[model samples]
Target: MHDIRFIREKPAFFDKALARRGLGSVALQLAELDQRRRAAQTAFQEMQAKRNEASRQIGEVKKQGGDAAAQLAEVAALKEALGTAEIQEKALGKEIDDLLMGIPNLPADDVPDGKDETANVELRRNGKPPVFSFAPLEHDAIGERLGLMDFGAAAKLSGARFVVLKGALARLERALAAFMLDLHTGENGYTEINPPFLVRDEALFGTGQLPKFGEDLFRANTGHWLIPTAEVPLTNLVQGEIVDEAQLPLRMTALTPCFRSEAGAAGRDTRGMIRQHQFSKVELVSIAHPDASAAEHERMTACAEMVLQRLGLPYRVMALCCGDMGFSAMKTYDIEVWLPGQNCYREISSCSNCGDFQARRMNARFRGAGDKGTRFVHTLNGSGLAVGRTLVAILENYQQSDGAVLVPEALRPYMGGLDRIVPHV
Candidate 1:
């Protein structure tokens, strides 16, 4: 959340940030809300004070054994006025909070100002795109031909945007998740966590997913929302707490199944496992002090890139344009892996430094050793990598001309040292 004080002090800067994001100036609307809410609070408090003083006058009148009828009636009217003021105060406060929640985080000054992915600046490209003398098939064509990916079965079980992996394919999917978790925790210094798949409304709010984008989530029969990513649980672990400064950087990682409704994303990536209603992923979350977030963002981005590096997959890093950035991120870096089948690079991981936007919603704070006050902890999250898409990339990129798929050297042990997958048929 942008500090209201900051917005108040620099309305033009705030509006300019919004314009770059393809949004109109909200400075007037937000400032109006702030003014109205504060006005209500001031009116409410004045009336409350008046009501208390009136009651005291009535008490003194009765104690003097004089006529108290006039004073009693005045007290009743004052009580009614105070009640109305309190109601208005509560409503205006709620409206102000909703307006604040709708505003996206301000982009970092260095982020390029542009609209959409076309304007996204590529920071670096690594590993050469694979070469194929013969026509290479997409992952869906390769997997379906190998008698492994059973989209037909998936359709029967759960309709669209889902897949069923059978035999070695299913085993390979599980192995990818385990391999990612081990690498992140056992070697990358991230503490492994087993987080809840179903979280409360506040957890989503803390992660800046609620109040907007509610349509993109799956609500359960009991009203609990399914997590869109492990980032929700892992990042919210320190919600509403004051931590010691010594633990300024808290790194946590989790491998969990994420569910998204994809409500607004109807026609994009409709084929295969590129986009899905359900998928497993390894997520990395960091809670860092303000002074450390900038450096930590680079470090976090590198961690995500490491996954693709180890798998020998070609990829590039793109700094997202303002309009293409996520709601809670001040700055973002997307790692797009090269897919030979698709003949393009697709985003496989996103690392972002949210600053204190989430911490404000979560009330998550930390205190320095000798500080008199606590400060919000800056939060960061990245996909160590999306396991499902990684599998698809592997199948498509490593496909042999003869319909066999070779496993990368790093994933060989995960796949039981089997060099290649053959058709089950």
Candidate 2:
């Protein structure tokens, strides 16, 4: 949510930021609505005061045994006028709020200018992509050859964009999640949380997923939304809260099954686990002091990169362009891992700094020891790593000549010391 006061004060700056996102000028319209709302509020206050004064006059006149009929009628008229003005004020306020809520957060000045991923600027590359002696197979092909990844079965059970992993493959997915959680919580200073998989509408709104991108999500019959990512729940932990400045940054992590309808994502990545209706991800969320959010964003991105580093996955960090950033992010960094089979990198995690956009929506604030007022807390969320995609990277990168996969040394303990995943008998 944007501050209307800011828009009122700096309409040009706000519109310029929106233009970078390919959005039309809305600051003028929003300012006009705000003006009308304030006018209505002023009218309401004046009418209310008039009615109070008239009532007081009526009482005084009756005390003196004089006629109060005129004052009574005037008070009644003012009462009706105030009611209409109050309604108009509320309606105009709601209109302004709706418009503000729909607008994406203004991109940070440091963000690159672009319309899509094609314009994203790569920051740095990590390990080199593994060399293959023979032709490397895609993750799906390798999994099918091992008779472990069953797409047909998943289709029968839950339709397309789904997969059923069995035997060592399934265990590998579990191991990936466990390893990510342990790494983030034990070493990265993030408190591990097990949040509800289903959330209320307010929770989604707090995270900028609802009232705009509702079609991208799945809803339960009970009216609760299936979490699209752990970011929703983890970030909302500080919703409507005001914390002490001492807790300048509160970091949390969760591994949860994410559900997405892929509403606008038709015919893209339809072949494998790359785009799935359901997948497990270890998400990281932080509530940080506004002054420190930029540094926190870098720290969070490094935490995610650490996961890929330990797995020895070749990846690159890219600073997302303004147009490619998420709805609530002022700035974002996407980590894309190398996939030899696909012969290109794919995004495995995105770390973003929301810069109080979500905090204003969630009413989350922080106060210092000597402060007389509170300020919105900056919010950040990132995928420590997507477990399914990590598994995909492992499968394609570690494929042996005989169709087996070598588990990464970092995940050996979680995999029960299993070094290799061979075809199931």
Candidate 3:
């Protein structure tokens, strides 16, 4: 959430930032609401003062043996007016709060200005797209041909945008997730965590996924929301918390099945796990001191890139434009892995620096040495790599003409020493 005081003090700056996201200025509307809220607050305070004075005057009249009826009536009237003002003040405050929660984080100064991904800038590329002896089939085609990925069964059980990984394919998915978790925890200094797959509304709100993107979530009948990403829970671990500055950089990683409605993603990548209702991901989150967030952002991105590097997968890092950033991200870097099947790059991970945007929403703060005040800690999250997408990359990049898939050397141990996945038949 944005600081209302900051917006009030510098409406133009806020509006200009919004403009870069292809949004019209909300500054004027917000200012009007703030003004009304202040006016209502002032009225309530004045009425409160009047009520106190009337009470004192009434007591004096009674003590002096006067009727005191007029003063009593005046006090009663003031109380009624004060109650009305209090309600108005509360309403106006809520209005302002709602508005603030809806506003996306301001793009950092370095973020490129654009309306969408078309304007994203490529930062760097790694490795090379594998040479194919024959035309590479997409992940789904490879999985289906191997008779382990069953989309028909998935659809029968859960409708569209779902798939069931059987036998070696299922093991491959699990191996990918385990590989990512081990890499992130052992090599990247991230503490491995297993978080709840279901969370509360406040948790989602704190992560900037509520009130605006609720449509993209899966809400249970019991009111708990199926997590869209492990980041939601990992980053929210410090919600409503105050930490000592000595623990400034808290890094956590989790491998979990993420559930999303994909409400607005209809018809895109409908054929494969690329756009699925449920998929596994190894997520990385960091709570860092405000001064350290920028460096942490780069470090986090590198950690994700390392996953691809170790797998020998060709990928590129993209600096997302302002308009393409997530609601909670001040800046984002998308790591797109080359898909031989698609003959192009597809996003496999997104690393973002929220720059206190989420911390403010969660009221997560840190107390430093010699500081009488607390400051919000900066939050960052990234996909160490989406497991399903990683599996897709592996299958497409390592497929042999005879339909066998060579296992990446790093994952062979997790695959029980299996070197390749061949058709069961």
The candidate maximizing TM-score is: 2
Candidate 2 structure quality by residue, lDDT tens digits, 36-99: 9998999888888888889899889999999999998888777777878889999998999889
Q: Candidate 2 clash total?
A: 0
Candidate 3 clashes between residue pairs 3 or more apart in a chain or in different chains: none
Error of 2 at 83 (Å): 2.4
TM-score of each: 0.95, 0.97, 0.96
- In the range 250-330, model 1's lDDT, one tens digit per residue, is 999999999999998889999999999999999999999999999999998898888888888999999999999999999
Better of 1 and 3 by lDDT: 3
Q: 143-213 in candidate 3: lDDT tens per residue?
A: 99999999999999999999999999999989988889899999999999999999999999999999899
Q: Which regions of candidate 3 deviate over 4 angstroms?
A: 53-71
Query: In model 1, where do residues sit more than 4 Å from their true spots?
Result: 54-74
Q: Could you give the candidate ranking by lDDT, starting with the highest?
A: 2, 3, 1
- Candidate 1 similarity to native, TM-score: 0.95
**C-alpha RMSD between model 2 and the true structure:** 1.6
Off by over 4 Å in 2: 55-71
Candidate 2, TM-score vs. the true structure? 0.97
